[model samples]
Target: MSVFDSLVGQSEVVERLKSAISSAKGGSSSQKMANSWLLVGPAGSGRSNAAVAFAASLLCSESGCGKCRDCQTVLSGTHIDVERFNPTGLSIKAEEVRELIARSAWSPSVGGWRIVIIEDADRLTESAANALLRTIEEPETHTLWLLCAPTLGDVSVTIRSRCRHLQLRTPSTASIEEFLLSNTSIDSKAAAFAARVSQGHIGRARFIATNQEARSRREEVLSLAFSLTDIDSCFKAASKILDIAQNQAESENSERDSQQMKQLQDAYQGTGRSLISGGARAIKDLERGQRSSTTRSVRDNIDSALLDIATFYRDVLVIQSGGEEILNIDLRTEVNEFAKTSSPKRSIERIEALLEARMNLGRNSAPLSTLEALFCALK
Candidate 1:
C-alpha cells in the first residue's frame, strides 16, 4: 500500500507527488523537486492528508510504502525529522513561528529530509508569516516545508509564489460513499445519507455516520427554519441555535481541557520555588489558550449550524426549480412544504442572510446579536 491510498478524489495530486519523489530520487535538475509546497483546497478536500503523504514519501527510502518504518513514524507523528504544527488558537503567533524555524534548521537526524507541515497556514499572523518567509527564502539543504490552506489567496502572496502550489477539489458524493463503505461498517443507506449531507467534508460525513448526537443537533438546527414564524418564535429559535452550538463546543472541549490541566499539574508537582513560579505562568498561558480554543470551537460549530441551515434553503430552492436531487432527502416533506410556501427569490434571500451572518461571525461580531438579526431576516 502507498501512503497516498488514504486520500480520496485526489488522484492528480497523488500523481504529482509521485513525480516529485521520482525527480528527487533521480537527481534531475530538469524536474527538480520543490523545497517548499503549498497545498490549497476546500475544507475536507484532503489538503492535510496530502501534505502528510508527501512528507512521508519524501522521507521514505521506498517512497511511501505504507508498511515501512519511515511512513509509519511520519503518519503517527513520532518521526524526529518530520515536525507538524497545528495551531490550537485562532492565529499562529510570531513566537511560535520563530521556534519552528529554529528547530527546522537542524539537519535531519533519522531521514534524508527534514519536513515541516503547517496545517492551516492561513492562520499565521503577519509577523509570523514574515518570520517564516525568510526561512523559505533561504531553506537549509535538506529542509522542506508543506503548508496547507483553504485557498491560495489566504496565504501572503510572497510566500505562496515561492512554493509549488497544488489545488485539491471536493470529493464527489459517490466517491465519499464508496470510501465509507470500504473503510467503515456503516450500512449503504446511512453512508449515502452521510455522504450527501456532509457537503464533501469527509471528517463530517464520518462523524454524522457514527454519532447520534451530531445527527440530532443537525435536525434541531434545521427545525429552526419552521420555527421562525413570528418575532417571539424567531428570538426563541436564535437562542436555541446558539445553545446547540455552545453545548457541542463545550462538550468537545471539557474533557481535553481537564486532561491538559491535570498533566500540567502533574509535571509541576514537587518542583522548587522558581520552577513553581514558572509553572504558574505556564498555567495562565494554558488557560488563555484553552479559552481561545473554546471560542474557536464555538464559532466553528455555529458556522456548521449555519451551513446546515443553508442546505435546507438550498434544497427548498432546488425543489422550487423542479430539481429532483436534493441534499436533505430525509426531510423531503418539510422541504416540499417550504418550497410550496416560498418563492425562489425568498430562498435566495434567506441564503444571503445566512451568508451575511457567517461573515459577521467570522468578523468577531457578537454571536447572539448576529443570530437574532439573522433569524429575524430569515423569518
Candidate 2:
C-alpha cells in the first residue's frame, strides 16, 4: 500500500499530488511554480491526512510506498524533511508562523522535497497569516507549502488565491466502511456501525470502532434525537446532548494530558526536576495547548453530533417521501416513526432549526445555550 491509498475516496487529490511530485523531478525546482497548495474540506474530511500523504509522496522515490523506511518515518511523523504544524490554540501566532517560514527557507538535507504541512491554516491570526503569505509568495527551491483549511473563506483570499486548490468531499458510507475495515481490527458489523455514526469522518470512525465509550455515547445521542417528541422531551434530549458532548470532551482532554506526560518523560530523560526549568516551561506550554485543544474538540464534537441529528431529520423526510435512497438506515425504525409524525414541512423546519443553531454557534454562541435554544425551538 502507498500513502495515497490511506486517503480514502480522494482519487482526484491523490492524482494531483502524484503529478506535482513527478513533475518536480525534471522541472525547475525554484521557479515559483505554484508551490503553495490549498486543500479545503469539511472537518473529518481527511484534509490533514491528504496533506500528510502528499508530503510523504514528495519525500519518497516511488510516491510513498507504505513499507519504505522513508514513508514509514514520514507517516509516523519522525521525518526530518517533512514538518507538520498543528496549532493547538485558536490562533497561530506570528512568531510561530515566522519560525515556520524560516524553516521552509532551508533546502532539504535529504536531496528531496522539503514539505511543510500546516493543518488548520484557517486558525492563523491576521499577523501570522501575513507572515505566511510573504513566504508563500517567494518560496525557496525544493519547498512545498500544503495548507489545509475547512474552507477558502476561513483563510484570507490573498493567501488562498495564490495557491493551487484541491477540495475534498466527505466520503460515502461504503467508502468509509471499506477504509475502516481495511485499516483496523474492526469486524464488518462494527465497521458498518462506526461508518454510519461517524458520517464519513475517518478519525471519528476509528474512535467509534476502537472506543466503546464513544460508541455508546453516539448511540445514546441518536436515541435522544429519536425520542424527542414533545416540549419536555425536547428539553430532556438537549440536556443529554450537552452531557454527552462534555463527557466526550473531558475524556479526550484527559487522554491528551496523559500523552503529554509521556512526551515530557521522553524529553526529560534522566534529568531531575530541579535541574530542568526547560522541562517545567514545556509542561506549562503543553497544558495551555491541551486546554485550547479541549475547547476545539468540544465544539467540533458538538457540531458533528448536531449534524448527525439533522441528518436523521433528512432521512426522515426521505423515508416519508419514499425516496429511493434514505440515509441513516441504521435507524430505520426510529426514522420511519419520525417521518410518520412530522409533515414534510415540519421535518424541513426542524432541519433548518438545527442549521440555524450551527450558524449561531459559529458566530461564537455557547454550545450549551445553542443546544437549549435549538431544542426549545423544536419544542
Best by lDDT: 1
TM-score (C-alpha, index-matched) for candidate 1 = 0.95
Clash totals for all models, in order?
A: 0, 0
What is the TM-score of each predicted model, taking all chains together?
0.95, 0.88
Off by over 4 Å in 1: 27-29, 270-275
The segments of candidate 2 whose C-alpha lies over 4 angstroms from its true place after superposition are 27-33, 185-193, 209-211, 229-235, 262-281
Q: How do the residues 1-379 of candidate 1 rate in per-residue lDDT, one tens digit apiece?
A: 8899878899999999999988988856688788899999998889999999999998888889988899999999999999999888778999999999999999999878999999999999999999999898778879999999999999999899889999999999999999999888999999999999999998889889989889998998999987788999988988888888889989999999999998888777756444457887988999999999988888889999999999999999999999988999989999999899989999999999999999899778998999999999999
- For candidate 2, what is the lDDT? 0.81
lDDT of 2 by residue, 1-379 (tens): 8888868888888887777776776544554336899999987889998988888777778767878878888899988888999886657899999999889878887756788999999888888888888788778868899999999999999899788999998988899999889989989998988887677788888888899877666667777676666877877777788777777888768976898788787768766554166777887878888888787777777887788788788888887777846656678888877788778888889889999998887666888778888987765
Cα RMSD to the true fold for all candidates: 1.8, 2.9
What lDDT does each candidate get?
0.91, 0.81
